[model samples]
Target chain A: MRSNSLTADLQPINKNIRKRFVLSRLHSLAGIVPLGIFMVEHLLTNSTALLGREKYNEQIHLIQSIPFLPLLEIFLVAIPLIFHAGYGIYLSMISKSNTQTYKYERNRLFFFQRVTGITTLVFIIYHVWSFRLAPVFYGTEINFDLVNSHLENVFVFSFYVIGVVGAVFHFSNGIRTGLITWGVTKGPASQRIAQRICLLFFAVFGVLGVTSLFAFI
Target chain B: MSAEKVIRLKVKRKDQMDSESYWEEFAIPYRPNMNVISALMEIQRNPVNAEGTKVRSVAWEYNCLEEVCGACSMRINGKVRQACSTLVEKLEQPIQLEPMETFPVEKDLVVDRQRMFDALQKIKGWIPIDGTYAMGSGPLISSREQQEAYKFSTCMTCGCCLDACPNVNSGSPFIGPQALAQTKYFNMHPTGKLTKNERLEVVIGDEGISNCGNSQNCVEVCPKDIPLTTALAELNHEANRYALWSWLKK
Candidate 1:
């Protein structure tokens, strides 16, 4: 009889089982923590536009003037977002969406999570580049006028709407998924309750996001 | 014997570990009501290829001629199933046999299922009895709970569910459905509930219940017709409550 050592060599080592477990848990958490919180803060800050250009620019200046703002962004927003997005891409690559065969609502929602992840990633990259970096690179005034002028273009307006919708959906749906995946909400009843709460999140954020867009107008 | 009818079979064969696998066709004397395993036995007896060339007998694994052992699971005509129960007569001609893909192929139709065992181990898939000393009888297990658990008890550790699951591939740590369902099975027992928290830690961990992609493929491919997805959902709920309780305790 052949020894099983030969078989052992063929098996791939799951070296990161512990690390992957921690990281996967953290991935779901990162979305809800600072990233989701930041989305709300960003939308609310932008909504200051409803108070007039002076108030909107003041809010921007206030945010920009916070002590150790760069460090805070790096720690809370940048690192968490990068880890969440990177791990999410790895998961999406390995995941085989089987909505056609399964056709369950949760299965469809799972598929959409990946879909929205990809779109949100693109939107985030473009959003940060145009609004944050472009101003620095061009030495343009970082004020309400600069933002409003960009939004005046129909193309930019459409892109912002799409980005907002994708981000809102990703965040809201992500909370529900994260809850289930983390074993926070286990059964159908709890999952349904979580879904309702998530839907409420979607509705609330949808209103805030759209209202924020109008502020730019 | 009425001019022996021949059954056509194509078996995926690999000579050794880390070797390229190739298909070999065999023409075996067909027997009425013979299953895939019977046809394989014929190939072993003759050791001749359909091309009329002499060859080594195909290697495969089976103990119970019945499906209860789960040792004879292989892909029959592109579907993962137990060869012992898969009747050759009911199958399409030129029956195709391949090993389950979720595990590493050892040789021919045999594959190493250490991964499945490891998953079972990770979940601690057994009830912990206090001691071997004469305890006349254990606590009464309710018939309702017994009925619910009986469905999970039928899991033969067959890789059918894992083989069908899209998440249990080489790159993934998802523990697959077989083990998850087994965790639920063990967790439901009164004796099994003692070590329940130990199992919950693994259940909520990386390779645990959360990795389920909700595809429902495992339920579809399970030979025993185990309600795998339902088991997962219930266990997932249990795991959540357990996790929250643990956190609050801390």
Candidate 2:
């Protein structure tokens, strides 16, 4: 059935193979997307704290109740990351072009984005281990309160502040780039729109994140 | 106000990728109608430095001296541009030549641009037309469409846009602006529309469009002035729509 549906996309012509070849780029790009989407969900869920910690906890618990939770995280989150981080590192090492040709303020942010994206990988594994897997392996109950408790530690909150801020910067830049890649913004007009969006997203993320860290510390 | 002023070419030189790089100044005999490439050719004819010392002729990359080839691109006065179109008279004294950092420097002003081409290959940056050699006229394209395609077609693949892009680097799989613009170009075609969803699928991926910081440097630096950021914005909406629609269909 799968083959039939795919074949219906086009005939067995060589063009079809070429189509698949082009489409296969998604495999590489997908490396960044699954995690990115989860982040959007994460932000929306966490933003509930604007109402109070109780609302945030209620949302978190509700999400945890989703069926097959463990498998979903393993496949959806872990698998995409394997590709995003692995190929990302491989590409960097063997890459011939380094895009740091310009040193504008925005360019500096881009440099930071690459550096942060790489480090974020390490932060993520530790995050997953400490948050998700540690409780399971040690047979301890973990929940939203535990996350809040982690924030109570100075080092832990510091780590969260850095990681989440870096991630927000990275993902907002993605939205800006997405506008360009998708043709939503173009010419000088799009440039203005992108600038506004970049600033807005970053500010929103920065405020929410900093506020959370402050509460924890 | 002086018309006969000479354009001093300060050429940055190296033997190979592994060789140490050094700067050599060559105040070549300048003329009224001269470009940076013409200035270099004058030095090529006589391999002598500004100090009148004999040295090995500088090595650089160029095919079609016309900007269409995109080979003779380099930094003139700290900006990425085609050496061919850069008028020497308007340039500041001591016109500098540096390789675009978008690729690995192979030597002097020559850098490895294989990755840009490879990205094109990875994105299958071409449309398939092999169905029937004797096939009739291809699909008709509107004038407006032709106007847009013409912008993408002007991409000399010079690596200039990549050079200007912040996300493009040895470390990031982010294919940079030129590739994403190319993806949009082909996808915009009538026949190319058949592969539209597939192209978007590639672009919306990790190393694809999302890595761009949207500084709009590519648009500013592009010699042909291709509307790059606009294409990227459109793709964002498409991807969002596609993901939602596909999930609904499922």
Candidate 3:
């Protein structure tokens, strides 16, 4: 008779078994610690446009004038964002969305989280390239005038609108799931409360982001 | 003649493993207080289709006639649940029954749930006591711990959690939520603590806790109401600590 023990079928644990866990933890940490904080700061800086062009340009000039500013951005913001985006794309590829079958609120949010992650990835790449990188290479000043002129085009404005909302949603929803992933919120009740708080975060940041765009035009 | 009442069932049937699947409709005489298992039993008894033609008897597995065995799990009305617990009265007409797609179908509603069993093996979901001989009374556990552990102890190895999980498909290497919860259950025992790191090894492996996509669907569809997502989260924390400690030691 065949043995009922399934030890033979089990995959042997390898020496590098911790690799995926380490990478996954790093991915979740990178999203909240650096990228999420940077997003909030970026939106707050842009919202200074509501105070008029001079206030906005002053904020940009203040940031650009900081000592070792390039080094700070590269080490803290750019590297973390790249790692988060790269791992996020791989995760989104492997996940199969079953919201149609399991129509729970959290399940739907899970699907949207992946969708927004990809959307935010693309938007960040284009936004950074055009506004930050292009200005550096071309020696063009990043001021209220550059952003205002760019947003004057309806299509560019619309893209920014979608991009801002998507990025904010991704960041806010990442907090909701990341709390659970890191064991900060383990039970359902705590998780539900976390969900509400994250939604509030999304609403506030979303408004600030979109309103900042309007300030640009 | 008075109109006859009937319970309509649309069953997805298969002849054998790796055979083409097809649908067969059955009209069974209405019976009060019948569950899905009894409905399938009616089809098995008469072996007749809705067209009044005889055909092969429908095949399914059921034991204990209760939800505890977990043998009669299938998708009823697009939901993965125990057929023994789902009543006919709660279902709409022409109830759709299909084998869970996560596991390979052996025939009709029966699936090869060996993957779930294999996962239990992978996690070493059992206490490692030295011998069958009488050991002294084990270390006493507080009722508080028992109450906390009891929630995870009720897992019947039902595949509903796996069926609803988006990450537990054929191509994915995930060990699913069932085994992860069982790992938590066994680790709560006094004797089980001896092999805790052994189980953590599996939890930190490639097909381990990291594979869970945090969709929380496993918790939603679980028949036992097992706190699967919570277990996954807690295990994620435990595994991370373990991994960090091992790295520091080296």
- Model 3 steric clash pairs: none
Per-residue CA lDDT of candidate 2, range B89-192, in tens? Answer: 88888888888766888888988888787667655677766674676767888999899889888988898888876557756667788888888888888777
Candidate 2: global Cα-lDDT? 0.71
Flag regions of model 3 displaced more than 4 Å.
A1-14, B131-135
Query: DockQ-based ranking, best first?
Result: 3, 1, 2
Worst 10 residues of 1 chain A by lDDT: A4-13
How accurate locally, in lDDT, is each candidate?
0.81, 0.71, 0.88
Which digits, one per residue and each the tens of the lDDT, describe model 1 over residues A1-217?
Answer: 4343311222222334335655666787799999999998998888788888999988998999999997898899999999999999998888766566455566677788888889889988988888788887998878988878889999988988888888898899888877766556655577789899999999988888878888887
User: Please, what are the lDDT tens digits per residue for candidate 3 over residues A1-217?
Assistant: 5467634354555667667878888999999998899889999999999999999999998998889988989988999988988988888777788888789988888899888888888888889998999999999989999998889999989989999999999989989888877878888889889989999999999999999999988
Q: Write one digit per residue (lDDT tens) for candidate 2, span A40-69.
A: 677677777666667767887798899999
What TM-score does prediction 3 earn? 0.95
Candidate 3 residue A118 Cα shift, in angstroms, is 1.3
TM-scores of chain A across the candidates, in order, are 0.89, 0.75, 0.94
Off by over 4 Å in 2: A1-34, A44-68, A91-99, A104-112, A139-149, A179-195, B1-8, B14-22, B27-38, B41-47, B56-71, B77-79, B87-94, B99-146, B149-218, B228-250
lDDT of 3 by residue, B10-74 (tens): 99999999899999999999989999999988988999999999999999989988788889999
* lDDT preference between candidates 1 and 2, better one: 1
Quick one: RMSD of model 3?
2.0
In the predicted model 1, the residue pairs found to clash are A186-B237
DockQ of each: 0.18, 0.17, 0.61
